[model samples]
Target: MARQCDLTGKARQANHKVSHANNKTRVFKQPNLKTKKVFDPESGQTIRLKLATSTIKTLDKLGLSKFLRKYYK
Candidate 1:
């Protein structure tokens, strides 16, 4: 019997010495984030930003609106 990697759809037996050739730890980092807000270099106006880890579900709950963004300024 073997354990399959859910992400890459690969199969490997349990604790069978994962080699550098089959390294999976280099995939991603924990702090997968981006700038929640970007300030203008000149006028400092708030620009709506897209952070990869900040998905829609979290935004919907945060009520991240244009007006609400004023607080950051």
Candidate 2:
């Protein structure tokens, strides 16, 4: 599987690293992702997902069902 947030689809970003001499090096910035087990209220089951930290925070606030409804729709 790719390094990405399943819920938000956050993926690695291309960026440049600048040195003191003004030389730029290409780099990839990866999102903060974690494997989490969230409970589905509607289904009454736990589902495991690879999610970003920010998405986890939002999930905590909105819950699994509400968050899915808001974003997936």
Q: Using TM-score, give the best candidate's number.
A: 2
Write model 2 residue lDDT over 1-73, tens digit each, in one string: 9999998999999999999999999999999999999988778899999999999999999988889899998
Model 2 clash count equals 0
Deviation (Å) of 42 in candidate 2: 1.3
Q: lDDT of all predictions, in order shown?
A: 0.42, 0.94
lDDT of 1 by residue, 3-65 (tens): 332212233233343467975443322333344564554575876553444343444555455
Per-candidate clashes, comma-separated: 0, 0
Off by over 4 Å in 2: none
Provide the lowest-lDDT 10-residue window in model 2. 38-47
- Supply the TM-score for candidate 1: 0.24
RMSD to true structure for each model, in Å: 13.7, 0.8
Q: Report the C-alpha displacement of residue 68, candidate 2, in angstroms.
A: 1.3
TM-score of 2: 0.93
Weakest 10 consecutive residues, lDDT, candidate 1?
1-10
